[model samples]
Each structure stands twice: as structure tokens, then as C-alpha cells.
Target chain A: MSAKMSAATYPLSGPAKVEINEVAPRDGLQIEPFIVPTEGKVAFVNALARCGFARIEATSFTSARAIPALADAEAVMHQVERVAGVGLTVLVPNLRGLERALSCRPDEVNLVMSSSETHNRANLRMTREQSQAQLLAMIAEAGKAGVPVNVSLSTVFGCPFEGDVSEAEVMRLAKAFADAGAAGITLCDTTGMAYPNQVAALCETFQRALPKTGLTIHLHNTRGMGLANAIAAWQTGVTRFDAAAGGLGGCPYAPGASGNVSTEELVHMFASMGVDTGVELGALLDVVAGVSDLVQRDVSSQLLRAGPRLRTHQPPAWMEEFFAKA
Target chain B: MSAKMSAATYPLSGPAKVEINEVAPRDGLQIEPFIVPTEGKVAFVNALARCGFARIEATSFTSARAIPALADAEAVMHQVERVAGVGLTVLVPNLRGLERALSCRPDEVNLVMSSSETHNRANLRMTREQSQAQLLAMIAEAGKAGVPVNVSLSTVFGCPFEGDVSEAEVMRLAKAFADAGAAGITLCDTTGMAYPNQVAALCETFQRALPKTGLTIHLHNTRGMGLANAIAAWQTGVTRFDAAAGGLGGCPYAPGASGNVSTEELVHMFASMGVDTGVELGALLDVVAGVSDLVQRDVSSQLLRAGPRLRTHQPPAWMEEFFAKA
Candidate 1:
């Protein structure tokens, strides 16, 4: 074994902290088969607010026909009780969505566009240039409303339609958004195609390029690399992450695949590593259980089934008897 | 962004390679509800052998009544085609198991013990000291038969019955085995209690202490940190890993949890990171499909469902029409 392989270079040392943005309400519920009632959505957001999350993306102000599951975006946004430290964010698709979201007085509005032209066109029915220009216009409008903007660049890692999205393309979009007065930028692995190396390399570049802007990683567990990618990014000092409770949100295009990295699992991993995410894991898990109930199915969360890492189990009856005899 | 977050410290740079040990036929099948026939086991092992694994743990030599799922261990081991590049390994529980496995002419024999006293007794029906003495004697026996011995220290990270196993305890056992001329030592996270920081710390120490002994990490996906821990260990230059096909095999103790990390998922993660595992992921995925069928259930493999990262999808019908209009 080489001495160079030692833990001297372990990125996290003492009392490190990361910000978790809960996106289950908007990202998770948007694609669900069952529509949670507006009250239920409001209740869920309130529950998450108490869990110490830095932000909770309450709902998306998209056209009702586009995502009927979260059609009650305004109701959820207006009804949710505000917490002092937790910022409430809502997705804004275009100028209309931004105007509606601004009327609700969201703390921050998230705008999204795809890095790959094909995915951009497929998802937004507009080309990359058109989406960027529209989002730039939305950023200016949201600025007038005194709300910060976070532009989520979908397929910054890879596109389902176009395959590998280049680093240059991702940098261009991220820089464009940062230049347009966006307070933060989220790199979305829309199809869970981002691996650890890709995540680390991109995060390093993004962080260096936009040191003043907050960087968030939005990953899916579609390929089982969500936590791996998140940890890799965290190792590179990228502190903000987007996770859905009970792993609820997934790409509509990737059939049969899991959703965003589970908030409980990501929190569990960071907490186990002694990195503070400010969220109480027990509280987060309780919310995850409610998520399972609200969604009417077992969600894709590992911590939901296998408790926390420190959870102990009793030995077999035979072993107990043998030990007693001994 | 700090300069410390740069890719200058990234672990893998060139054609880095790691060894993968397929343990599905043994560890994976042992915990399954369905029992595959002897020929099916042989065929599965043969298929895995062709996938370029460094080693294939084919079966365990224990009483048929103990784990009836793998009762045909002898038959499967004897019938598996001996691929030149792939070493066939079998689990040997005691002196009798060593003798039985020797008769089948296994390329290697893996002994078992638990670092925790409670897990040791619960798993092997003996004390840790007694198990170590017995394994040492068996190692001498295997040495005479010219078969190398690798001791798998279960719950090295944590024991379900005995919450946390100490690093000193793990180091003591690993050093004992290395000093006794064991070919390798596998640190088994019997339950997925391992976080990446713990994995990195332990792997670094184990690698430094036993430089000559091959270090293999056997991780479970119980808490969804399987790939994260694997990558963390890989970053520390501990190359050998043990994975099961279709992610079969769970701790009969940790109910409602996943089993070992899926072989295809691990291979895919490494392949995606540009790290060479020498296993053809497509071939491994095909075998995973077989394992899924043989188990008569959908196994806990993400790659099995999501396909590879680069698998492109055609845009929706409307998007295609929109593109055509453009």
C-alpha cells in the first residue's frame, strides 16, 4: 500500500455543513400518478420546513395541463406556513409562471432549461436559445419582484435524447444564468447519467467559474449512482444539493427508473460522515413515511426500510440461548 | 472556490483497474427464497466466469441443512467450467468444510469469522477466539492442499447485534490473518452500516498494515451507501471488491433491506468513471437478467432496469413532429 493512499486528504474534517433543498413537492409530486390534495401538499411542505432544510421547493407554477399532479401550486405555496430559516422556492417555467409565482411571494423562484438543444426542445417545446432567453427574461422579471432566481440546468450531465451533454455546453448555460443575476444554479442529471468523476470534474469547474453563486447538484438514483455523485460533489466543496423525500421525483422519459436521491438517505450519509445538513434525520424520516402514505405506495428510500446506520438488531433466539448457557 | 477542491487530487487518472469478485452463486443464492437447480447454478457460474471477473466465489462448503438454497454447492463447483483467468473460490466454514472444498479442488478457500463477539457466535456458533483458532488451523490445512485462504471478517464496520466494531479489533484480526499467511482479507460490512469516511479510514489502515495481503471490500446496499463506500475505498487504492449478481443476497437479519451491491451496478459505475474492471458490463447485465429470472423475482439491481448511462431515447412523438416542423 502506498502512503499516498492515506486519509490525510479526506475532504471533510470537522463540523462540515451542507444545505439540502427539498424538492419533493414540486419535483417529486409532479410526476406522481396520484395527486396529493392542496392541503396535503401544504401540510407536507410545513412538515419539511420543520426538518431544518435550507429550502423546500413547494410547487411548480407550470400550466395546469402540463402537470395536473401539482396543479394547485398557488394553493400549496400560499397555504404553507413559513419557517424562519427555511426558504420556500417554487418552480417558474416561463414569464407567466414567474408572474403567478411572484404573486404568491415565493422566497426564491427556480427557472429550468435543458443544456442539450434536443432535451430543451423536447421538455420545454422550445430550443436551448429560446429557453435561455425566456429564462433570462424571467430572471429580470423576478428581480423586479425582489425574489432571487435559481436556474436549474437540466441535462447538464447527459441528455436522454442527445446522450452526453458536453462540459462546454453545461458551462455556457451555467455561466449565462449566473451572468443574468441568478442567485444560484442547479446542475440537473435529468436521466441519472452523471457518474462521480463527471460530477467532481463539473462541480470543480462550476464552483471555480461561479464562486459567488451557490451551486446545487440535482441527481436521480436511476443508475444507482445518485449518492455516489452527491458525495463526490460534496468532496469538491459543493455544499447545496436537491433531494426529494422518499426518492419521489423521476424523469418522465426514463420509465421504470428511480427518482431523485432520497433526502433521508443523503442526510443519513452526510450525518454519518459527521457533516451537518441541519435536518434532523428522525424528523426527515417521519416526513418520508408521510410521503409514502401520501403517494399511496412504497417510495424508493433505503433508509425508510433499513433504519439509520446505528439501528441495532437482536441476535437470533438460538444465539441468545447459546450465550446464556455459556 | 478553494484550490483544494480542484481535480489535482482526483484518484484515478489513466487506465486504472480494479478486481471484481463475483459472489452471486454463493453469497447471493444462499439467502434467496428460491433454490436454483444444480445445473442452473453451474450455468450461472459459467456465465459469470466468462465475464472477466478476477475471481468467482462459486459456493460454500457447509451442511446442506444449514442453507438449503445452496445445498448443491459441491455439484455446482465440480461442474463449473474452469476459466483460466478466473479463480474459483469457495467458502469453507470449518475443517470439515475445508476438507470437502479441497476434494472439489477449489482455486481458493475463504474462511469466515466475525470481528464482533456477538456476531461471531450468532453467525458461526463459536467465540471469536475459537473461530480464529479454528480458521488458523484450517488455513494450515488449506496451505498443505496448496489452496490459498482468504478470511472474511464479517461486521468489520458494524454488527447488527453489537452496534459498532472497533478498528483496533478489525486491525488485530486482519494482522493475525496476514501474519498467518492468509492470501487476502475481506472486510465485510455484513449490514450496510459503513459510511464513506469510515470505509476510507478503515481501508487506508488495512492497506497500510497488510501491504502484502489482498484487501477486498464486501459491502451491502442496505442503507444505499454501497456504491459510495465502494468508490471511497477505490479512491484509497483498495481495488478488490465482492459483488453479487442482480444484487441478490441480504442479511437474513436485516429484513426489508437490499443485499450486496449489484455486480452490474458496480461494474457500470466503475466503467462510467473510466476505471477498468476488466468485466464486460453488457455481458454481466445479461447474466444479471438470468439471475433475476432464476430467483423468480425482480432483484435489487438499478442497471438491470435503467440500462447503461449512454443508452439514448428517442424524443416523444410531439417533440419529433415539432423538430420536423423546425
Candidate 2:
């Protein structure tokens, strides 16, 4: 091996605390038709917390009629024992949802606004400008209530309804979110339509546009470009990323979309290349297996299926002998 | 967008020639049970030749009893017309096969040696050393007959029995092949167990060892790291690659060994990244579709399923009008 190959080790440097915001509880479970028991939800949250994730999206505070999946959000929240240093965040669509989230006493509140007008109207029955206004008010209210807030901009790439999204549009919306007292901005490719070039270009532009605010790119591997895009984003200097454990998460509204980028796969790729991702692969797989059993269906993650790359185990002598004899 | 965004342009470079050695007629059809008509094989070869492939593995000259799939090897040789400047190669496992390939007047002859003892013994009924000796003898014979020879070292990553193959062992075998007057060495990940790090490390080591010899990394996406490994190999300065159109080729003897790296997908990835991989995506997909129809199975090439990234179409006027109305 050359000196270069031996020197493959990335020191974890950016943040002492690697905040893995668990979206599976909200983003993953919300899409499944099977309503998991409140106990299951509580157990799942506890399990994620045990995996060293500091921030967990405990549940969404949306209307029961709107998202039936999160109907028992309040009850589930009440049952779970909160871990120290772990902040629970909940998605709040409007003032009513924000009020509900506040009642749960979440550490952080996430307010989302769709960049595309068509999606905003289809999703919330409100125009994009109206949704932004609602988000601004929610941010102001959350600030006064002493709750940290993060805003997720959905369909920042090409939207299903509007088709191609311009860089100018994404920047304008990102600027609006940053101005609304939001602690961070999460760029979401809701339909999994963003290409690697688009991702790199956008990340570079956003980093320059908002240098002080943390930028997290939440990717959907619906088109198998998630990891490629992630690499491109990383190349463009974006640090924070939102990845679902075992590749578990998708938009219910986006038809044919599969899963988010697998956390195991992501960490495996980075770690193999000597990049520090602050994730333990073996421990992560244990969590994936636990959740996969609860879900019943086979998960879409390949790393879970194939195990980590270059990972091997020595078989017992008898097993080796048997194969050798054959 | 700044100059940084300009770097995101697809096919990031001008048209650079990639040596596309079409393996369809040989490695592609050799594992099938059903007989693909001679006319069909000829047509496939003719189509692939026009698709800007610099090299084509036309057929194998092995015994019909061992591989019934390539029974029409001589017929394909006579029927298919080669493109000017496109080198045609054939696989020859033994001296008899070499004699048969020589009769076909192939531009180059490929001698394959499985690095795994168990596979070499089972497949060729010979030990690894014995197979290597036979391959060396065949190379000598081909040289005497004025035929250029390329050596493919299979099972270089891992073996079914050995589990893990060390870099030293792979290098030893690669050095032996180069010493035997082989034109180039193809380092194959026969089991699809190699990751990008391994690929980079191994390719760099091999290149350092044999600075004069051309190196080709043939990969399989059995575990979803094929493209990543290929990219890693390319970045490490190993330019030549072997990909099956629609990823059609694999060893029939190896279980769970999936398809080769898809030609369409590889071409698309390179083109999208602004790297010049001379093979045209549309033409390659056409070959993939032809092979898919001939084989009667859905091949697992993602590019063929999901059209190239940034694929666009004109919207209907009525739809636009309706959207304006809405």
C-alpha cells in the first residue's frame, strides 16, 4: 500500500456534538398505512435516542384529519422518557400545529414551507406567499415562547407540479427563511428530482448566500442520485445532512418515490473514504434490524441487506473444513 | 451563477475516447441456456460496433459441451462484420480454444485465469497454478501465431472459499500475467465484494507495479458499489473499463454473482459528470433493450429504467392552459 492509502483517516472536526435529527419517527412512519401502536412509537424514539442521536423528530403536531399517521402524537410524546442532551423536535404546519407542538414541550420546532406555489396550494390549501407569511408568524411565536426553530424548504430543486425550479427561486426562498429568525435552513428535494450538478451548484450558492446559518440538505434517493448528490453537496462545502436510518423515509405525496439516503450507506461511504460522519455502523445496523422487524416489510436499504463493504467474519473451523472438503 | 457553478456542466469535458470492449457476443450470451440465433448475435454485434466501442469481445472458442451458449462461435465470427479501427477479441480458455479463436482471425485473444483455487478447479478442472501455466502456454502459442493477447484475472477481490483476497496475492498474479507477455491486465472483482477504497488502493498498487501495462477494473453492482468503485478506479488514473451493455455478463458458476457494470449507466454517469466515456447512452440502451428482448428478462441497469438525469420534455399546450386557469 502507498503512503496515501495508509493515510486514509478523517478526523471529526466541525462539531463536538453531531446532531442526528431522527426523521424516521415523523418522516418514515407517516407514510406507512399501518398505524404503529403508541408504545411502538415510544419504543422507536427511545431506541433512536439510545443510538446517540441528540435530536429526534418525535412526532408531527399536524391535525389528525390531515395526517392520520401522527394522530396519537400527543399520547406517544407523553409516554416516552426523554433522554438528557437529546432534544425532541416536532413539525408544526401552522399556528394550531405550533400550539400543539408547544404543548408537547419539544426542544425545537420545525416549520416547513414549499418553495413551489403549486405544491404549497396542493399541500396546505394556501398559496406560497400565504404559507411563507404563516411560517414567519410561527417563527415569531416560537421565538417568543423560547423554542429553537428550523425551516425546511421543500422542492428546492425541480418540483413535480411546476417542473424546473430556477436557482434564483431557491435563493429568494432561502433568503426569506433566513430572514424569519429561523435557526437553520434544510433544503429538501421532496420529489428526489435534484441532480448532482444541481445539488453542488445550489449548495455553493446557498453557502455564499447564508454563511452564518447552518444548511442541511435532506435528500430522497427516489432516483438513486442521493449519495452522488450528497458527495456533490459535500464537495460544495455543505456539512449538515438529514439521512434516514436503514433508508426509511419518503414523501407520501410523491408517487414512486422509494426511500431517503440510507444512513448506514452514507456513513459507510464517508467512513471508507476516511471522512468522519460520527456514526457507528454496527450499532446503526442493530437499530435498523429492530425497526425493520417492527415494520414487517423488507427495508429498501442495500447496506443493511449486503452488510458493510469490506466487512468480513471468520467462520468456525468445522464450517471452513466443510467448505474446503466440498 | 459564478464560475464555480459552470463546473457543474454535464460531460464536464469534451468528447474523450473510452475504449468500450463490447462483451455482449461472448461474455454476455455465453451464460444463457436458450440459444440466441446467429442472425440476432450478428445484428447485436453490428449495432454495438456502430456505437463507438473501440474494442469488442466477439466470442469464446471453448468446447460446446462445457458452454452450449457459445456453440455458434464460429458462425458469429463469420457473420458479423467488424468496424474499422475497432479491435475484435475472443476468449480462449485452452490451447484448443486458442486454435479455434486463431481460426476466426480475431484481432486479440483473452485468456482468463480465476485466482481462486476452488473456482479454477471446479470450472476448468485444474488448479490455479496449473491454469496459470496453461494460460501462459496459450499466450506463447498465440504469440507464435501472431495474435495479441489480453489477460483477465478473475476472483481478484475475494473467493467463495478464501473469503478475502489480499492485495499482495492479486499483485503477484497480476505481475505473473504481465511477465507472460500479456498486452494488458484486467483486474476483475468477480464476486462484487470490493468497495471504492479497496479499488483505489489495489488499482494504485497495480499501476505502480506495472507502470507500462494497461489496467482495466471490471466491476459488478451486486452490492451497489460498482459505479463508486469504477469512479474510484478512474480517479486513480486507471482509464480502461469493462462494462456489459445493460450489465448482461456474469459467471454462471458463481452463485449470487449479479450483472456486470451496465454500459449505459457507466456512459451516462461519465457524460453527466463531464467525463468523456465515448460510448453513446442511447445506442447502448438500444443494445440493452435488444439483449433484454433476446434473453427474455428485465436486466438491472438503472439508466435504462430511469432515463438519464436532467431528461426533459415539452409540456402540452392544453395542460399549460389548464394550469393557468387553475
Instruction: List lDDT for all candidates, in order.
Output: 0.86, 0.74
True-vs-predicted CA distance for residue B117, candidate 2, Å: 5.7
Query: Per-residue CA lDDT of candidate 2, range B3-35, in tens?
Result: 122233432111233455777678878886667
Residue-by-residue lDDT tens digits, candidate 2, A1-326: 01122234211112212235668888888877777788888988888777666577888988898889889988988888888877788889999989888888888898887887766655566668888889999999999999989899888876666677888988887888788778888899886777666676788788788887778888876555676666556655666777778778777654445677767676676665655555667887788887766676776556666566555433233443554575
Question: Compared with the real two-chain complex, what DockQ does model 2 have?
Answer: 0.24
Most lDDT-accurate candidate: 1
Model 1: residue B270 alpha-carbon error in angstroms: 0.5
Second chain TM-score per prediction? 0.94, 0.91
In CAPRI terms, where does candidate 2 land?
acceptable
The digit string of per-residue lDDT tens for model 1 on B189-300 reads 9889998888988987887788889999999988889998998887777779999888887767543446889889999988888777899998998898777678787765
List runs of model 1 lying over 4 Å from the truth.
A1-15, A254-257, B1-15, B254-257
Model 2 vs. true fold: TM: 0.82
Scored against the true structure, residue A58 in model 2 reaches a CA lDDT of 85
Name the 10 consecutive residues with the lowest summed lDDT in model 1 chain B: B1-10
Each prediction's fraction of true contacts recovered: 0.68, 0.09
